[model samples]
Target: MIPPAFRDPVHDSQSAFRRLLKALSRPGTPVSLTGPAQPPAPMGGPLAAIALTLADADCPIWLDPALSTEPVRRYLHFHTNAPQIADPKAAAIALIGDAGRLPGLNEFHPGEAAYPDRSTTLILQLPALTGGPSVRLSGPGIETTASLAPRGLPGWFWQAWHENAARYPLGVDIFLTDDRIVIGLPRSTKVEAP
Candidate 1:
């Protein structure tokens, strides 16, 4: 169902991008990513915001086996010319589903020692995210400190992140979106168990 808000003529795409940028620059800091009243079918405004901020012709995105078909594929193609690659190995951006289906950190491209920044970014749309185990993080862009309520992501996710962070600049960045909200976790942010 389309929300009433999208009808406004002033629905600005720039705002959505700015929010995403702040979050990317400051990992672990939750930012509210708003978008045009309605996004393409299936994917919500938040996910749409992510696509708008990140995807482009230069970026090769991998649509999950689930979303590789029509409308979603066409919508992304029309909106952002990001080519959809068949293999995750060659993809710069991976739009995935079912966090459980994601491969271990060692599996995806973690970039190389010379150009760790070459690693692919995985934009995984998950089932849901809520008060996760309380964990505090403090880093470059963070002020004194910050904490998340506690997410239900499985232990495997954390394990992978730990290993990924170990790779330093080589690790892939993750942008997680539920429906209306999107959260970013750059490689630099340290996640701890409370």
Candidate 2:
């Protein structure tokens, strides 16, 4: 049976949304998500909370093959009432369970000049949130530069991120999560290897 959603949808969702906004605003800073529901296997708590908070009937979600499981689909559908789309370009949110096998950064919609906000937002679930190769981040919302060391990402991720960042207002945004912590990486942020 599918687990129940948050005990109080209004309050819980609002709290989660605030945390997400703060994370996105201060890119690379970690935020903790609290909710009543615990997601099934392969879906971290923070990621599940994000899906419930951000996704709705208007937003369609795309799942990587590794995350396209019955329990996950059921949970998201029952809680968010969001459609599941097959094409990555059509997804408002893309969930990547295994960053090691992540699709090319360009595969998803980068949005258009006229409507840059339509680009997909990725939620990548990693094994750990710290202690890996660090990347220097600088841009809006950053004073000078911030360093982040997200573990379990593919080696080519930084290079692809550089290319994606070059797209300016047209690139997708990302939220990296483990079990409880979440860090945002908006497309506007410049990522450099350290």
Candidate 3:
């Protein structure tokens, strides 16, 4: 059921779509959006806008264990006509809670040599965004170290990302959303510890 606040997606879609598009267009940047995003049972909170902006018939999604319930999956399938996949490599979108449990940086398809655009996008249900020990992201789209409070970019990820960077035009792009805001990890952004 659409939330009471979002009875009108036709209108809401415009703003939500703009925020998502802008976030994707600029790497190492953050965007804030709010409104009728009442996610379904067990799927918890961020489900609403996530369903609205990311799902579609052409994209395949891989749900984390926390989001693997039948009701949640069914709701997404019914609404978006998006297929669900078991392998992250096959998914165009991967929904997860802990970025830690996801397959090592090498396992998922980080796009290909030529068609680097064919990479997976990961959406995480973050516990919170904080300041300590965080990294600063900056590059082409970022004006400065886009001081990001990303919680779980595991140690190995930094190492592997260096490898992905080696692939240059071929690497995965990341979009992270918390309860209040969403941020980007564009393939072009560089990460350094704060």
- TM-scores, all models, native as reference: 0.82, 0.97, 0.85
Query: Can you give the lDDT of residue 73 in candidate 2?
Result: 98
Weakest lDDT window of 10 consecutive positions for candidate 2 = 33-42
84-183 per-residue lDDT for model 3 (tens digits) = 8998888888887666666675666788777888888777656555643566666777666577666665657655666665666777776676677776
What are the lDDT scores of the predictions, listed in order? Answer: 0.69, 0.91, 0.68
Of the pair 2 and 3, which is ahead by lDDT? 2
TM-score of 1: 0.82
Ranking under TM-score, best-scoring first? 2, 3, 1
Candidates 1 and 3 compared by lDDT, better number: 1
Error of 3 at 99 (Å): 2.5
Instruction: List the pairs of residues colliding in candidate 1.
Output: 6-37, 131-150, 132-149, 132-150, 132-151, 133-150
lDDT of 2 by residue, 127-157 (tens): 9989889999999989999999999999999
Superpose all Cα atoms of candidate 1 onto the true structure and report the RMSD in Å to 1 decimal: 3.5
Looking at model 2, the pairs that clash are none
Best by TM-score: 2
